[model samples]
Target: MGEFLMDKVDLDDVLDKFGVFDRYHAVSGIFLVLGMAWNAMWYFNFIFVTEKVEYRCADHLLPNNTSANASTTLWCANPAVCSEWVYDNPDSFVAEFQLACQEWKRTLIGGVQSFGLMLGSFIIGALSDRFGRKTLIVITGVTGAALGLAKSFSTSYWLYFALEFLEAGFGDVTSPLFTLAVEMVATKSRVTYATICNVGFSGGLLVVLIAWLVPYWRHFQRVLYAPGLLFIVYIHVIDESPRWLLSQGKKEEAVHIIRKAANQNKLNIEENLIDMISCEKDEGLSFFTVLGNTLKSKSLLKRFIVCSVCLIACTFASHGLIINSVSLSGNKYTNFALSFGLKLPSSILSGYIIAKFNRRSPLILFFMACAALCIGQPFIPKSKYLLWLLILTYMAGKLTASMCLNTALIYTFELFPTKTRSSMHALCLAISKIGSITATQTPLMMAYWSGLPTAMFGGVALVAGLATLLVPDTGNKNLPNTVCEAEALEYSDRIKK
Candidate 1:
């Protein structure tokens, strides 16, 4: 009987027994979406609060403005040596910190947050795999929210900068939460869950637009952190991933959770089904062991490298377009909102495409489209109509890049095994942050030549898109349970081709 059960039981089989979109999953999905949205708010909040609004040298710096032309002279004066800046919004971060002259420092504020995200991905991700997904989510979510709230009360620019770093380090909760969310659902529903998470993220981006209504940046910052309070409720309602539990040799606990899930779904799961579930070994592998094992396998190593490149390219292209889009000649608020809004449909389309087709082709096509648009954006003449066309094309590119990013995200999740999923996801995200860091420099590149930054983004994405073709596809495939299983899938895929 034991041999029969062991031979038959797998995660998918269990998921099939319990309803896939049942009550337990619905509840868990709601919390995960909210958590993911909150994470997105923190990650992208810098874009709004630190925006570069129009400014001019202080009144005192200019000669007595007895003549109307003095106003014009003040605007035309060398902005670098301004003693004090008069901004369109006196309450914005640019005005409060007088950061107009220190444009590079302004850019660093965003870059530093990405640095924090990179660190959090590696450190917190490893901890999630070692401890438990729910534990780290609660810990990071609360701490990150507190730090974000503290940032609203910042007394100095340096203090705010420090808080940004800490907030990002603790607030990078999306990856683990996403992993848990995916693990909770059946294999066929993974794309749906991923797309839902992306939609949540897009919702968060739209939420940031509310900053336009607030009178001050600090007030806006406070609003952004308010959602973090949901983590308290999440701690009570969210369950630990049963897969993670099984991997740790906690079969009884895993069974208990599975039964609870089954009960929640109003399905009658057999006692024998729970008994059948078991782990091969529970030696408690560390993050380095997983990393070492992945690197040792040539097949996984190749896949890892390829996925990393895709991640970087997607990060760079998506964020580069978003940040640079603000500089376009139009209402900054509208453009920003429209750029983010494009994600809603893009995500839906991405989910459908990946479900119907394979991962590699759609990803490659999205990247290529983004590259084409970015490469073509600069060539349009600078008339008002032409500039709007340029903005349209750029936004289109953003949409394509966003699709690639969402697709790459699910693809990366499918590429790794259950044991190392969180850790490997974190590594990919950490490497992607390097692309984000590079993206923050787009403004600097624009100062040299407006087209140079977009061209660079296009060129990088082109290379990454071509490289994606080299990786194996996991469409309609079962999630692997171990490193060896993932390697076997790759080997089998190669043989079939």
Candidate 2:
């Protein structure tokens, strides 16, 4: 009787009975999304830290006049070599360190920070898959924040930058939390869970922008880094993912966690049914096996490349549109907040649309619509003549791009099997960072052509939309536990010769 019951029970079937958003998941998700809101501050902190500082030459770069001061000296047609600079904002790092002529140093700090974040994604994602999600989340989340707070005391530029690198390379809690969120819910409810977490991400960005009112960098750092420590409490509150536990062949432990959820949801699950549950094991902890399977499978490899291209476009456009959104003539802080406001709303709408229809069509539509909006940007005349029109058009692009990114993440997450899902998603994120890095330098393209940045964004988005057609739609599929199961994710569209 036990053997018969064990053979008949499936994990998803048991979980679906708990209902997608049960009280257990609700309690777990509260901690996870709050962690997201806290993590978002550090992730986008560079936008505040590297803000442009107003400066002027102290000496020879200006015309020789005894009356010349900081403001009057700025009119110099050519900003030649300068031994020193005067600044308006004394608390700014640029002013504090006297980084008058070395603009690249300022920019390099941002680049180094990004590079560290990229590396963190790879290391933490791999570790989470092997070590367990709750452990890494507590360790990395607190450690990263502590390192970031430590940077507040650095007296030298290089020392401050070193802390920046270390803090970022320490990894984030949100990645593993996101992995846990989808796995905790039913297939039909995955989008709902993912978007709610994403809203928390945007919420963090909004929270950090308020730091513009903090007055001092150290004070903001303290405020930003302090909340992250609260995540350490997750160790006691949250347990390991039952799906991951089952994959690792820890059936008794997985069943214990399931029982907790059943009790919280008040579901009268059968004791015999629970007793007969079995765990599913996949290819070992080796990430190589996952990659090897992809390399060998023709359809998966094709789908892999297609998802990569879409991710590239999503990351690139999302970053580029953010910079453009703030470049409009207005209060940079207000503009930044309003620009990203659509992020939260669009994610909710996109999740509904994807859950209702299918993944491929909405993704294709969002990407294509973003392409159209961005492509027409240069022809829209100057902000002075039609300010609302300019903001309206580009903000629409930002909205669509935000939708594209959220959907792309869910699509990629659904594409791979559960065992390697976090790492595979991380790899895609790491690859997509190339586009992110490139987008940062895109303003340089304007030296060659005034409209080049907008043009490039449109081009990549168009390519991503077109490339998406080659891949299968994952809307109708369940989370695949094995590579073979994932191969049929084309909504049962089997490979044909």
lDDT values for all models: 0.82, 0.78
Query: Candidate 1 residues 85-138, lDDT tens each?
Result: 677678788888877657777889899998998888888889998898998888
Best by TM-score: 1
lDDT of 2 by residue, 1-497 (tens): 86654665667777778665678888887888788877877876766776667776666445554444544435444556556667768788778876765666766666677677677878878777887778888888889878988988889899998898888778567678888888877777788889888888777665545577785777777877877777778888988888888888888888999999888888889887776666776556666666676778887788778888888899788877775555667987777787777788888999999999879899999999999998987678775879788778878888998999999999988988888888888777767776777776665566587667877888899999999989888885779987888887764855532
**Which 10-residue window in model 2 sums to the lowest lDDT?**
68-77
Q: With candidate 2 superimposed using the best TM-score fit, by how many Å does residue 114's alpha carbon deviate from the native?
A: 2.4
- Evaluate residue 240 in candidate 1 and report its C-alpha lDDT on the 0 to 100 scale: 92
| Best model per lDDT | 1
Q: Cα RMSD (Å) between model 2 and the true structure?
A: 3.1
Runs of candidate 1 exceeding 4 Å displacement: 1-8, 59-84
